[model samples]
Target chain A: MTEDKKSVCKPTVFEELYKKHSKDVFNFMFYKTGSKANAEDLLQEAFVKLWKNCEKVAYEKAKSFLFTVSSNLFLNEKKHEKVVHKYIENQNKSSYKDNDTPENVLRQKEFQDKLNNAIASLSEKQREVFLMSRIDKKKYAEIAETLGISVKAVEKRMHNALVILRDKIGKI
Target chain B: MKTEDNIENKDIFLAKWIAGEISDSELKKLVSEEDFNVFQEIKNQSEHLSVPNFDTDKNFSAIKQKLETPKKKSKVIPLWMYAAAASVVIMISFFLFKTSSTVIQTSFGEQRIVMLADSSEVILNAKSKLTYQPELWKFERKLKLEGEGYFKVKKGSTFTVETENGSVTVLGTQFDVNTSDDFFKVVCYEGKVSVKQQNKEVILTQSDAYQNIQNEITTWNSKNEAPTWINGEISFEKTPLKIVFESLEKQFDISIENKTSSNKLFTGTLSNTNLELALQTLTSAMQLKYTISGKNITITE
Candidate 1:
């Protein structure tokens, strides 16, 4: 938002944009395409496109621009994508430490795996909204803005994604 | 019915819960305890999920490298694609060249100077037709000729002039070829040429002439620098009277009837551009009288 970051043509400002949004953009592409390599490629391509049109893109609008561009790039590609799973890192130990039985640990791990699969199997739209809200800790309004969708749509996807995950794990 | 009502309102309450707009008491008012518990677990578990590592610095430099050499980035079109395109173009042009031939024809009493693709010159005589392929001329300098033509070939590949009776082949030369019914003659005025007739080839040099008239082949020498026809005069050496009359007919676009049918061979030069002068010269030399009547002429010995 500063005057220094106004011109994304500058290397420093461009890098600033890249650093701020590259992870989120990369994650968004990963959630859509379900391939890390594809995500990385789209990430690079989106930033490169941004750099090409740096003079025109305002710094505040760059994040949504990157998301829109990355999503469009993913859509332009062939739709035969593998289901996304197993990118989930370990959970915080605080919740599990109190009930640290070996059977409890194994059950938690199983639940987590099922949860990951259920999330991955969600429709690409729902998974995108859910993860952006939960993993990125983005608000529904922020998710809707980044995704160029209505806040109501984001919340609906989030709720539907939770319902699917709960169904998959089935009362555990 | 109460559970059905709660299920319908679940979207609103869940949206409120996820947005942190509703506390537990408010969420518990809309949904069953078990459903709220499941939603909480799904959210908590999802919070732990994250995308794989992306090295920001490494990719930034990659993008920087791409931007730095903006001109070098091109579509990943394979080399075989270019090769395939080139082959297609070559094939199309080859077929076009094979199927397409240019024929240059000069009507009666008409003379045309055709400059070939290789800059070779062909001065087509009256009632002559020349056919060649311009695309294939670069590799092969060959053409079919009917009637008479004077060729000034440039130095390159072997140039060939094909006629019904014989063909004349030369590396580079200036020559004159005249072919009609039962008469084929090639006169070389510069450089060297090989005249082939009925399984026999005879090479000729400056001012050398070869003739095959009525199946009798002979070689003669000429004293002129070039073909005399090019200078508005048609010259011949011991040519048959039938062929001479035919030549006059072609040049003047007039039918000549030689009533004498004389077997004597004619040797003379006649003005081709002037019908009266040419008739006078030919008839006087042949010791004959000629009368003309509107595109028709009669000769009596």
Candidate 2:
């Protein structure tokens, strides 16, 4: 379906697939590396790959195929020996942590505190796939395709990841 | 809810609950139980996760500017080291070009802005594609776009953008093309654009759209409105039924068909109505019916 993805004139089918998958792949990588800068770079890199081989990608399977490529690229990038520039530490907390209220402020602050630490403690794969699927709103099927796993496996993994996170995150 | 029997049904219940397919009574029962606590915990955790949608306008613009700058002169090396240095240069250039070109791609519902050979820019909307052929760009300033793209061609002697539908030849022009679906439309924004659709040729100035309607060629003048949903709003005045559905299809990324072919002639002027309202208005006006599930929007007589 995307055979002419490399064609100069028309918009290829793979582009639509990339638009659908970029957020999922980037968020997955971001949650894994715990760095926004790295996630952005990785996302851009993953898209470049999709454009090159767009001809092989069918419209029906583009979503899954993109994820698979993203996950692979992210994993390879993570297996680096040399360290480059350090990530810019998030000195200023995101406004997301600040709730507007004098009464619930204390509780919201406490909730934020727990979330910060709990999120840091999840295993690599668990955190990466979980956040990609949950936080980025990617479907389980997309996550599974990116990780080269079955949908059932993705479901099980997501549920397990959620369970671990639920036990540790928030004020439940 | 914590009973062994209830525990056995939890997964099925959870799936149904997420989809909102559970009966009201069943939902009420579940809400009143301890399992609801677990569900609440999951929701709380979910709420804490934040998505930071960063804008890369600066990065994109800076890269584009660099691409547009005229070529700089390279320093010459000694002739004795020419063979070795040339081979080294070739290898390095090849590696850099390959890595950059192969690293990014787009899918349906995705658009990317790319810096072309001439330094003029193109914004690809969803379901559109742009590819960079760096090494071969010097010979012919050419780039490929699939799906659809809005091109702001920079002023240059020779610059052209290609698509499966046709080729737009121009030195500099601002134009938008819808190339993803079966139909291909070109709307010139600023300068003139000559659009070549295979054997059939069409040229469009600014604010004009070259569209093929039901196998008969037709051109839409400035009076005929262009699609503008990408800016998060749509304005239609006295637009036909088929065109309205086409624009809506791009916005919702779903198909809306008039299968019965009963009221092929539909006229409406819509602005800022919700998608459902728009659908309802069109369906009611034409006395047509539709069934929607997932991404599928099927229409009937």
Candidate 3:
């Protein structure tokens, strides 16, 4: 297993993997925890862990490893925080809204709030697949690899997530 | 349009659209559908979701720096490798120091004073050369000399001067040794010196001189404290005319051509400071005529 990993995990190969997947992993973490600081911290921790185990982890499995490590970390953090504490904490921080007219700003803020609440309402599996597909701009094949599911399963979960988000957020 | 089949088909289309795999016609067809606006709105908003600003260059540089620093548990060089490297350095330094032995030479008509590693002094005559190993001087006072030199040895261990013809060994004394082609001479000034030629050994004390001419060994007494040539005078005692002319050539930086036989012996002194007067003195004493052209002197009888 070590020799198999060493054949694939060269430094240049690892760097290419980091470039290909880091932003997606960061977005996956950010949407999962809904906190930029926590997402950044988890992103660094995931890659550092990848480097530490670089010789043991195969290059092709790097994406799955990053997503799995990041999601587990997010789940562990979620188990420690009370729902009320999470709500209050999210309420204190405003999601990024572009500068516009007063009415536009209010409308964008309302839509962002509804979007966040809609996302928060999703099942863990559905949300993970949806975000990996949508926000990370990953293909169904990549989403399936990361979530350890079939491509058809990834599509089904992503479709369910979109339907649920559309219902919660209402019309545009 | 609101049928279950239509809903399933729309979900597949929406997934394709979000994955950016939808063809242009497929996208146009989807946009014209009734529920397309909702899915498009979700897709647009999701794409615009803000992520944390990650400075990848900065983070990668930090990682690179961490990897470059030698870790405490990194593989240590093997002991034999360190020993090999040390031996290589030792060999290089040994060769560098050994080849730094002192070598002194004087051109024709040029004289110099040399101070050895042990503070001993030597007055080297014209066309002389001397060499000694400075690192081994204290343990063994040995030197190699060519041509002639006057040595004022400091009282120490046995001082040995080697020449092409023979070797001279002394304890602590002043002496002069002249080693030229087929001729070797040693004159002791203040102390004793031992001369070895082939199987023969000769020792000389103060004012004692030993000369080897054409395989013949001769001894004589000197009235002066040093060789006369050192004081701007060239003196010879039963020396061949050929040797006398060779000395003149060395002392005056001239080339002498003897067209006639020069087997006769010469025993006289000539002033070394004046070329013309020295030539006159030598020629008149030998009843030989000579002519000088530039630096060349021709002798004829």
Candidate 4:
């Protein structure tokens, strides 16, 4: 058990992989899900999946697996949230509450709300792709690989998310 | 990039537009020269969406902490998922917990589903508050509610979902209890849930009903009821203007600035639409001019 694990068991390899990719993985998830809590959950789940399948998993392919699992799980959670309207209180120092505008930030409060709704309203997968692209700032190649779809599909969802947002918020 | 490329390239046009990198030819492709002016109006609204105030480290940590409990399979859901949520490896370095003594509170439209140490799950509604003595309740799982929550209590010998106005005692059942402004409603989705309102106890059995909303219980008595938000389904039931705004806020995690809200109530059944289309329905229905300003939805007369 001891001597052969180093021969085939690659925890050392996995540790190195975690060090290299966990940040990007977590960031991608955080941006996609729009909740730190959901992001963290996805991040851990991705790694756990990788660990369980470590025998067939390669370091290079790990990134793809993590992102794929993350995207799917986040989408699943969004789809079946179970609890309705579960708010986290005392949880944030909300970056900007001041709604400065032509009206001097009067609508600032409403702005964040609209953004949240806009994102939430998006098809969970589309929202994920958009957040990962813009907020996590992921590249098309990385996203395409992780999503197990063509770059064209990723771009399409990203495009649809934007269109829906523009149309929804644009009229308001 | 072919004959019917418009269907495919339509998304590309949007992507390029969002990046502010659209070409002249593509710009023309989006809208004809005549409608270009009007299309831009909608496009202007479309570009207003963006992620905000995201601190990756802090957020990841908060998620990690909530999910840090030991892996226990007390229900149908597999425990593998929770383990994936709070692994120490993925645990971010920074997290901010609530400083307030209030154990349960929601901001704006945020909802929380909490599984107590005993494995009962509760869904807290928007702008609600729940305060319970966390300690000194080892023998019996005790908590107080001041807002709306749907509880799925794990089978415990003495289990109760209590509130300021009333309390619901349970022998392991599922129910939704909404207690606010001295009005209380308890709807049992599963099992037997009894309501106690000051020396009066009424048991709510499942038959598709709503309890104590604005001082009346609306019972459809159909087994299939609408728990829209839980499934990310937007069900707008010809509600009032203010309440509609409130629903929008809850659904989007955003708000609207109403200098003065209208008294007119709306009645319609709206089931799934993309977020924008849904909001657009409001603007069109109200005939109000709305300017989408980067996460902010500003409406003017």
Using DockQ as the measure, which candidate wins? Answer: 1
- Give stretches of model 3 more than 4 Å off: A1-172, B1-100
Which candidate wins on lDDT? 1
Q: What's the DockQ for every one of the candidates? A: 0.35, 0.10, 0.13, 0.11
Candidate 2 residue-wise lDDT at B299? 80
Interface RMSD of 1: 2.0
The 0-to-1 C-alpha lDDT of every candidate, in the order given, reads 0.75, 0.53, 0.69, 0.55
Docking class of 4: incorrect
The positional error of residue A5 in candidate 4, measured at the CA in angstroms, is 15
Query: Clashing residue pairs, candidate 3?
Result: none
- Alpha-carbon deviation at B49 in model 2, angstroms: 23
Give lDDT tens digits, candidate 2, residues A91-119.
Answer: 33443345557656555556555555655
For model 3, residues B1-301, the per-residue Cα lDDT tens digits are 3355455666565566667766544655645553566666666566666444667776665454344222332221212222111000000000111132456666777666666666676766777777777657779998788778877787889998888788888878888888777878888887788888897888888888888887987788877677666667777777888878878887889999999886888888988778999989989998999999999999999
Model 4, stretches more than 4 Å misplaced? A1-12, A31-34, A71-104, A107-109, A170-172, B1-8, B24-29, B32-301
Query: Candidate 1 on A14-110: residue-level lDDT in tens?
Result: 8888888889998888778777788888888899899889899988888988988888888887532554455576645544767599998887788
Better candidate by lDDT, 1 or 2: 1
- Model 1 residue A7 CA deviation (Å) reads 2.0
TM-score of each: 0.48, 0.41, 0.43, 0.38
Q: What is the lDDT of residue A50 in candidate 2?
A: 52
Q: Is candidate 3 or candidate 4 better by lDDT?
A: 3
Report lDDT (Cα) of residue A48, candidate 2.
56
